[model samples]
Target chain A: MSDIKILQFAPFESFVSPTFWHKLAELKLDYDRLSDTKRSIFGYYTNRKASGCLLEVDYSAYNSEAQVPKFSHVAHGNIYNKNTIEEFKALDKTALLADEGKQLLDDMRSGRALSDASLLTRFFVLSFADLKCHSYYYWFAFPCPLTPALELLSPATKLKEIPNNGNYVEAISVLPAHAQNFFILHVNEQEKVCEALSLTAALSDFDEERAQHYIYCFADPSEYENPAWLMRNYVALLLQKCPTLIGKSLKFLGLRYDQQMHLDNSLIWEVRQAEACNYEHVQFVGWEANRNGKMGPRMANMRDSMDPAKLAENSV
Target chain B: MHIPNESKFRETGVLTPEEFVAAGDHLVHHCPTWQWAAGDESKTKTYLPKDKQFLITRNVACYRRCKQMEYVGEETLVEEESGDGGWVETHQLNDDGTSQLDDKICELTLDESKDEMFTIENGKRSPLRVVTTDDDNEDDDEAIDMDTFEESGMLELVDPAVATTTRKQDIETNPSNLASVVNASETTNSADSVLRTRTYDLHITYDKYYQTPRLWVVGYDEQRKPLTVEQMYEDVSQDHAKKTVTMESHPHLPGPNMASVHPCRHADIMKKIIQTVEEGGGQLGVHLYLIIFLKFVQTVIPTIEYDFTQNFNMS
Candidate 1:
């Protein structure tokens, strides 16, 4: 009982560049005037040289077609821009996250996540851009379903310690951009051959007898001792796709890299997932903590930087 | 000056847009912490490639105010000799054979000091730069008198080390018993001694007019709240804050104005460093321009702990 370790995932720390707010303000004033609709946005997290789980959004995040930087995986998200601060404050935060969680579960159950595993790591932002004062109030939520908590069957192992991990890392690197985020590494220890497969193909080729050979891998942005928050949903998707694997010990690879994109900090975990009483009533928990590490929205006062009158006053 | 036709960086002390890109690429390649951000697409400069608009490094910690670290160096001699007026010249590199450049900067500082006084008289909330001049040795007595008067006028002029020590003691004593117990354990552990210090997000963008890479800073306080322009000056070296640092909008990002280190003197300084490196029989490549730029920018904001690998030899 003392050996059992419940896997604690590191939550993401949202890093919104000033350019992100500026673009949001522009969208509010020009295009999104009085329209508090959910806008499609995307953020990228790098697996290379990260100190923690960091999800960064900049001006390019608004561009759906924006190229993800090398060694980075894109997480598709939506920005719900509120017209007024009052509206933003009055919005039910729990319901918002639950909606996103439901979408994730639906995607996983409908075989969408198996085909495109990126959907498993969805995030959203609720924001109110105060153009008058150039202040922006915002909160980010990386929707993750909380159910059937995974326990470690054994202690986390470094990727380098695993045999022929170099081959797995090499194969994973050459995968397509979309497939690179979440994939399966099929390793045959006797043959000493490892191959990377997409989640869809991996699911089809899933053999119960060779379960130990299948290493579910995700490009991890976390440099901490624990895996990142994205792994929670990744495991949930795996369970949804293959329900027969419930209560079975599985190998997961949190593929991390250094600045040189060398697989130095990658961690492998042997996890056992418990069966949830009801998968239909899944609970979601993922609202990002503010700077104070509290559950609240943060305000960025851009008056000195954005307001022309204030800029003129300061220059004088 | 050895002028190479292929590269004007060594000759002009200024970098062409291509040279700026090359230098930036070099910086990002070695110091992966510094990344090339595309910035706002609408505000992209035609000179720079869309994706390589600027170089940015965020969350660079500033553990203490500049005043706290001021007395630690040989500048204490300058502090003892020059009084209040000498504060402007204390941070100048003594070994750098750039007295002519120093004199020009001093003249500019003197002129700006007068402007600072006028702004204060007008009751305008201008960022303060304490300036007193010690050009004449005979006026040393008067300068010392002025220093005492200025110290009274500026509340922060009190000895910062003493102030910080007392503040730390207050923090240690004020917490509840349970909190103190936890803090005591944390102190013994040593690994959890993370201080809530001020941090700065630094950005380097190419200035078209000056033909030098301009450095911009956005600071946050211990609580991670954005630091006001006046609060930011506390971290910047008092000598350069007034003359070199200005509140300006970032060229790449449309946001509130950021504190930018004006590039007017950057080319002159870079040229001097290039000459020094050349005199030592080493050719200065444009790729190493940003490394040298960051080294000198350290003089301006000495407390911000941004990484510029210290392995390279300048001389």
Candidate 2:
């Protein structure tokens, strides 16, 4: 089994109840320490709506042209600020998409020619805390190049009706919109583990020396058991406290650690959606075995995942 | 001699061992003997008693008054006066500033003799030589070369008392010379005159991980012998020596062994030099690397003097 694990979550951004802060305090988390303002809330997205994510375009699994920057601050600095997010959102649908966004669409349409920088930037910008906190979910529908041979089933088919498949791996990135820190979580379905790694940098000055640094693994074994289950509960509780995440579109991110590639070129997957159902558990529909959409590999899987043990064993 | 405080030489310029030797030679030539000591064993000698000893003496010729009582024959003069009248005595004082009587002497005719002295007087106000016979002999028709003969009789000498007095006179004139010899030997053994200096051999290598030049102290000296651990304590400054001794490791050798090291500021200086060179697209060679290393090491090991210009077999 791979030593590292990853888990992905669709973030819900809203004003969390004061009781949630009290709960966070009980968990030894200082919620007030997240931001400078007292008005700030726990605005990060937890993976409550998504049943599980699938392994997509693992750079480690392929010999492809890839690069992952040592410092993520460079990408963070290039992204537009809060004011520009609105302007981009207000643009017409036919407007020229960003170079990265266009590259993402092109790669998804043809599961080949993946550009590392475009994928990283697309996912990073779409899940930006500023945009997610404002209930903007259009960017969440990020283009991903996953063409796995999944079984064909009707859209209305119950998630439990699908047969079991072997375990899969996925790359994920989770950001709390109200906080400066972010995480890249790699999910290993077979092991049922999530390797949560933290990436932090100074936001005020992107080029600050020692600005972007990474803590390889932030999750202790004790704290990270059944990572998918923990993520589900955390997200559910977060949404209950901050209801704004409901009906809000959010882009979820995935990451695959690559020794040879830079952070920008490393495998990154993005999925976009607005929570549309009241189901307590998250669900995902894989690309059917019919080779629907000519997807390369399934990047995410939605299934009945309210059960903690089943979620780890199920195809995601 | 005492080693100068290293702080005094902080920021002073540095040179290779060769350059150091050249400069040292210059200083030795210009300064008095007491100011600097040679670092090389071959260049210096231990001041010893035998080397400092020298000869001191005075030569004196004495003449006695003579009066003939009767003439017996054409070639002989019979003297009625006794006590060796009409004779001269010449005495040579010994190395110990003393003289002995009852010694054989050489006699010759005034015209035939090569003796340069006319008269010898032992006194405070006058030198022993009174006149020279060269002028008188130059005009004399009777001047003739004669074989000198040694004799123990029929020779007139100056007052007997003067002979003993002349020995004292020689001693008085030369007391300081003897005193100096004794002084030299005393100073050589005295603690006040101990020679103190510090020296080291430097080796430089490129550190791949740190991406900087690393300098290693391969050896150091205590009075020209490879220094022992105890002597190192005496040479280096107290605080630095303590730190250095603890952190030292053989930079170039493989073993569980350590040697004294100087760790302060070597990297900072090298980094700055590299940055400057990179800006100009300059490359560095072994010689240039050593030059830069020496220039900076002086600031750290200020108390220990070095001659950087000395040739090193880098290969």
Best prediction by TM-score: 1
User: Residues B177-279, candidate 2, lDDT per residue (tens digit)?
Assistant: 2112111001111111112222444433333233233444432221122332323333343345445433343333221123444444454565556556656
Badly placed stretches (over 4 Å) of model 2 are A1-316, B1-194, B197-199, B205-211, B218-226, B237-239, B244-247, B251-256, B262-265, B276-287, B310-315
Instruction: For each candidate, report its DockQ versus the true two-chain complex.
Output: 0.09, 0.00
The superposed Cα distance between candidate 1 and the true structure at residue A216, in angstroms, equals 2.9
Best by DockQ: 1
Q: How much TM-score does chain B earn in each model?
A: 0.61, 0.29
Candidate 1 stretches with Cα past 4 Å from truth are: A1-19, A44-60, A63-73, A85-99, A102-117, A133-135, A151-188, A193-204, A219-226, A255-268, A274-316, B1-11, B71-197, B271-284, B310-315
Q: Give per-residue CA lDDT, model 1, range B203-252, as digits (tens).
A: 99988888889999987644344665655765788777767888887887
Best by lDDT: 1
Q: What CAPRI grade goes to candidate 2?
A: incorrect
